[model samples]
Structure formats: C-alpha cells, structure tokens
Target chain A: MVCELCAVAKKEVESELLYEDNEIMAVVHLKPAIPGQIIVFPKHHYPIFEQVPDKIIAKMFKIANKLGIALFESLNCHGTNLLINNGVAAGQTMAHFSLNLIPRKEKDGLKLQWEPKKASEEELQTAFLMINEKSKELHPDLFGREEKNEELVEERGRPKEIKLDKKKENYLLKSLKRLP
Target chain B: MPEEEYSEEERKAFEEKIKRMSPEELKEFQKRNCVFCQIIIGQIPAKKVYEDDHCLAVLEINPAAPGHILLLPKEHHAIMPQIPEEEIGHLFMAAKHLSHALLRGLKCGGINLFVANGAVAGQKFQHFVIHLIPRKESDGIKLELPQREIPEDILSKINEVVQNRFNELMGIKKELVKVETKEHAEKKKEAADEEESEKKKEETEKTDPQEEENEDEKSEESEEEKDGSISLDDIASVLNGGR
Candidate 1:
C-alpha cells in the first residue's frame, strides 16, 4: 500500500498545502485535533523518526517552528503544541513520520497533561547514569566531528548522497510493509 | 492609605515599571523570575541527565514516566516563536538524542517528544522546554489528541491565513529565490550557519550582564523552598500501578 503521507507529499491527494520546498511539506490537517492544526513531514519516505537523517529532522523542526508561529498569529490562539509520536506504543497511528502543530487556547479542554509519576531515588539515579552514558556515546557526531567532515566534503564538491546498503534498505522496506 | 489599597498601588507601580522597561531589561526581569533559569545557572539543584553548550536535559521531579526528561535551552526564550531557527534546530537535535537515550535507558516501548508553547497549551512555566516522555504499554498517561471534523470552509480559511502569515514571516521572495540548484542551496545553508554563529556570539555577550543581574537577585532573595520532592512511597505506588 502506498503511504498516506507519501501521497500528501507528492500532492496526489487533495490536501490544504500550507508550505512546500525541496525537502519538506506542510499541510493543514483534515481531521485536526484542534482547529488550525498543521502537519509537517519530509518528502522522503522515513517510516520512523530514527530512520530520518539528522539534517532533515532539524529542517523539519525549524519549519514546524515557523508554522507554529504562523498558527499563533493566524488563529489568535494562546499557544501551540509541537508533538511527535515516534512509535506505535506512543500513539503513532501512521507509519510515515510527521510532526503535529496543534493550536491551543486557554481551557481548551485538550487532555494532554498527565499526572506526574514519582520514581524512586535509585531508579532516578540509574536512569540518570544510563541516559548520560548513552547520550555521550550517541552524540559525539553531533558535537561536531562528523558534521565538520560532511561540511568539508560539501565545500570541496557536490554534497554526497547517502546510499543505504542493500541489506539495510531491504530491512527498512520490510519494516515499512509490516507497519499498518 | 489602607493596607490593601497600598499593596494594590505597589502592584500597579510594578506593572508600570515592567511596561516601561526595554526589551533587554524585560528579558533580564523574566530571567530573574524563571525557575528553570535558576536550575540552568546552578542556583537550583536538579537531577541533570544531559548537558551541552546549547541545552540541558534534566529528569523531571514529577515525571510522567520513570525517565521523563525536560530539555531546556540555556538561553531564555519564553516561547517557540522567540527562539531563533538555528537554536530550535539545535534543541530538537539534542532532544532526538535524549529521546533515544530515554528509550535505551528505561527500556520503554516508545517516546513522545512534546513541547507546549504557551500557557493555554499547559505550559506551567515561563521558560521554553521540550518534554521527552518515555512510553511503556499501559503507562496510564493519556495524551490523547482526539480529532474533530472541522468544516471545510473553516479549514480553507485557516489554510489561507496561516500560509500567508508563514510566507510573510519567512520572507516570501527569499523563499522563491531559494528554489535553485543544489550548489546554491548548499552555499545559502553555509551562509546561514555563519550568521547563526555570529548571533550566538552576540547572545552570549548579551547574557553576561543578565548573569550579573541574576547574581544580585540571588543575594536579595533567599531561595524559596519548592515542594514535589520525590519519596520512596510515591515511587512504589507508581511502580505498582502507575506504569
């Protein structure tokens, strides 16, 4: 089955397209959670947030921020919510990753808030150590080593397109097909 | 004057003072009042999970889940609109990593990255923050965003208004110009990066005076104690049924 958001990105389906550029698209949500809610997604088919490249994620968020400000101005709402449900358990209905910019007002009766749960001191400490170590391990590239290399490569010539290996590509396609 | 009348007069004078202040002064005043800024500057102790130059991630004292984290930018931005695009990008990138860490650390099923831009959106604090809530099956957190069928005409009207406003904010002509070759896009991105770095330098310089002001306020006000302290009983109850 064709991804619904892919259709939206390609403009195959009728959508209230708000903004479009080379890499991203923003359109007004049809069945909105709130009035003036907009959905922003990348042109490429990334089934999950982790699959999307860092640069595209950044670009999507920056665009979402702009659209968020637009919602505030146009709808005259009190605020906006930038929400991303990354997996099935997190209430991600669609396989295609998208960001929701929900316009909100005072006492709008949106039930997004949760009662804060308390974790034990040991649990909190373990979490802190585990996350700190994992973050340090995963975020070295973001701290400017590989990013500089990519920039240098781009400066030298045309930016290199990242090609996934055949196995990884197959895995991604399989996962996409597996998801509803 | 009566005591109530005297206090009301004082409150009015304070509001007038705030209104008369410059933008920089207003920012400093807000910074002095923000609790998160105090947490960032080491005035208030927090259980920090991650910290970089651009942002800090701390475990929520009252977490929605076991490892829920609140990622905050070091600078004072009251809302999403006030933040620069580059800073927004950086913050989200950091958030992505933090979410990943939450998943791996807590062994949760998923993650929800949530940001409330203003008071009506359930933003209790004045500081801009991104909430990374770790999700497990039957976690009992209901962040259900139920869809409503809006009228077609209303959607169209909203579309036009928001699209026009967005284009205006983004500079429509500049966006049109940006539709060009890959080389041109790369060049433009590099130029934007340089400009962002320059802006960061200017912001750091601007924050120095605010830091001094914060120090003065710190001396004047004894840190007011805040509740919501974690306890083992609360955690035991959460572990038993909440999650």
Candidate 2:
C-alpha cells in the first residue's frame, strides 16, 4: 500500500523534483548515469504501464516530451535517450514505474549496445502473421470497463481504512489538494 | 477529385494480388506494409494488451521476457526523430500502463523500456517502436554499459564535436562560431580556413535564386556528417577507437 513513488507523489518522501503536474512528476535520479538523467512517473501508484488509464499515460508522455526537450536544450547534451525498465528482467531496479531520460554525448562512455539476433525472412513473416492473427481477437473496445472493473473489485478487498502517521497524513492531504 | 472506378473483375484481381504479395511487396505499392502498422489498422492480428485511438500496445511475438510489449502510435513512423511531435509522448504513456499490466498481470519484478532508433541500435524493424522488456530476478537478459577510460584531451575533443552536432540539430546557430573555434584550436590552427568556408553558407543563401533547394542538399550532407544523427555508429566507432 505504501509505495516509494506514492510517497514521493504524496510528498511523504523528498526527491530532486524537476516538474510536477496533477497527473505526473519529473524528478532527478538519485544515482544519475549522466548529469541530467531524469525519471518521470505518474503521480498515482501504477507499478506497471498497463494498469494506468490511456489518458494518464498520455499525460505522462506529454511531460516526458517536455522534459526531454528541456533536457537537450538546457543541458547541451548531444542527444537524449528515453528508456523505461518495465519488468524485473529488463534491468528494472525499482518496482515503481518510471521513465529514464538520459543525456547522451559522444564518448560519454554510456553504452546501450546489444548484438541483435538475426531473423530469417520466413521467421519474421511467421512471427508477423501470428501476432497479426492474434491482434484481431484482442480487446476491441479500447479503454473498456473490463480491466477497470476488475481493479475496483481488487480495491474493495483491501482494508477500508489506511492508518497513516499524523504528520504524513497532513502532508499527503496537502499534496493531494495541491494537485489540479 | 472523384474516386477512380474499378471494374469488378479488376478489383477482384487486385484483391488477389494483395493476398499473394509479401508485406515488403505491399510496401512497394505504397500500402501499409509494416507489421505494426497493419496491427494498428486491425488488418493484422495481435494479442494487444492496450489500445486507444492515438496509440496501441501489443504483446511482442518473441518476447525477451513474459509480458514483453511493443508500444506504438496508430500512425506509422520509421524512427523516433521522424515521429510526429504530438504522437511521440503518447506512445510512452501507453507503455507505462503496459508496464503496470505486466507487473500485476504476470507479477514481474521490474521492467525495462528500450527504443532502438536505427539499425545500429539493434533496430531490426523499420517501424518505430518502444520495446517494453520485462525484468525478473536472474532472467539473464543483460543491458550492458561497458565503460572505457580515455585520455582527457581526446575526451574534450569528442565532447566538443558532440556538442557542436547537438547545437546544430537544436538550431542554435550563434554558438557555431565559438564551437568551431574550440574544435579547431585543439586539432590545429585551421580555425580561420574553416570559418571562411562556413561563411560561404550564408553568402550562398543570399545570392542563389534556388536557395531553398541548396539548403535541402546541404542539410542532407550535414545529416550524413552529423555524428549520431542518422546512426549512432559514429559515436560507437569513436569510443572503440579511444579504447
């Protein structure tokens, strides 16, 4: 229930804040790979990408684009690298979802190179057809109540009252009000 | 303009041609050929995790891990830089939701989001996509960041070059003179010679009736020369050279 990112969004935890809006926040990473490496995330506790609503995702990316442009312009870096570590296998350290906006310069010693496995034309076509066929049977009604309704049931199972520390509660309430 | 009328037989033949053609062949006819584009239009099927009018997220066929997803806009874009400004942010927003889905749906520990722009960045497919690679403990899929030590002088020179390129991309022309001088001072005192050549750019624009056409060619040339603009191979080569 008490997530680090939730705490940060609620102002329970102090972070190097860059930009914050009602839907999302951009903060400096504690251990930066580059000078201006930033982490942008949604204000609410959405651990992974799929749980958040489309509108919320759009807002987060809007912030990311702004942060990216600002990062390049203000920092004077050669280019920028925007990355997100989704699940644990992808080198995701934190459980909370966040996008890493890394400032890249020539010979900055920041390397994200990988040897690609070659796929034959046939193999590629096979994969393409499989994915294509499966896509047709997917959730046709975009942003339907199906997933959200399930989440509501999950929420109802949890304890109704959350006993927050008095100081933290006040801070969290203030932060909540501060949000548009 | 009125829509062209096709005879029923001709239309039937065209449909048959479409069925016979590979995706690449479809591209030659200026049809939607990219697999991801086809998915967007619902022509090709996908095990879609998320979809909205502006964007869509689908399960990757050869996933690096369980719940690995590919997020993209409904519109097709070959590379990140070429993506429309408005659609750029929405794709990642969708990815955020997909990441949450993987965490809860598959119960993965963490996640990694990767965007491979050109071929050098391991971008096999031409269509721009953000790969949502799920991370779990001991999954063994590595994202390596190998560091190398280089001499300070060379490092500074590299920095200057990269900075100049970035400045040019950002359209900060005022700093061009200062950047060129810094670059030339280190390599040699060839600063005056380059400056004279650089002055020709502005002069040509003023004198030429086909200035717009000339500018287009110059940009294309500069694009090839610009390190990490078209491909990151230039930067990679420099780093490798230093080692």
Which predicted model would earn the best DockQ? 1
Q: What is the lDDT of residue A91 in candidate 1?
A: 73
Compute each candidate's TM-score over C-alphas.
Answer: 0.73, 0.48
lDDT of 2 by residue, A1-180 (tens): 466677888998876566666988877655555545667888877544445566666566666655665555545555666776654345545556677766666666666644334545454454444433333333222234445544533442332222223562242233333333
Q: Model 2, residue B76: displacement in angstroms?
A: 3.0
Per-residue C-alpha lDDT of model 1 across residues A122-149, encoded as one tens digit per residue = 8788877878776656554443253364
Computed on C-alphas against the true complex, the DockQ of each candidate is: 0.29, 0.15
Candidate 2: stretches off by over 4 Å: A1-16, A45-53, A76-78, A87-90, A113-140, A143-180, B1-67, B78-93, B96-110, B116-126, B143-243
The Cα RMSD across the true interface for model 1 is 9.4
The complex in candidate 2 yields a DockQ of 0.15
lDDT score, residue B135, model 1? 80
Real contacts retained, model 2: 0.24
Candidate 2 lDDT, tens digit per residue, B11-50? 9999999899997786655435567777777888876666
Please state the i-RMS of candidate 2: 8.0
- Please identify model 1 stretches exceeding 4 Å from their true place: A141-179, B1-6, B9-13, B16-22, B173-243
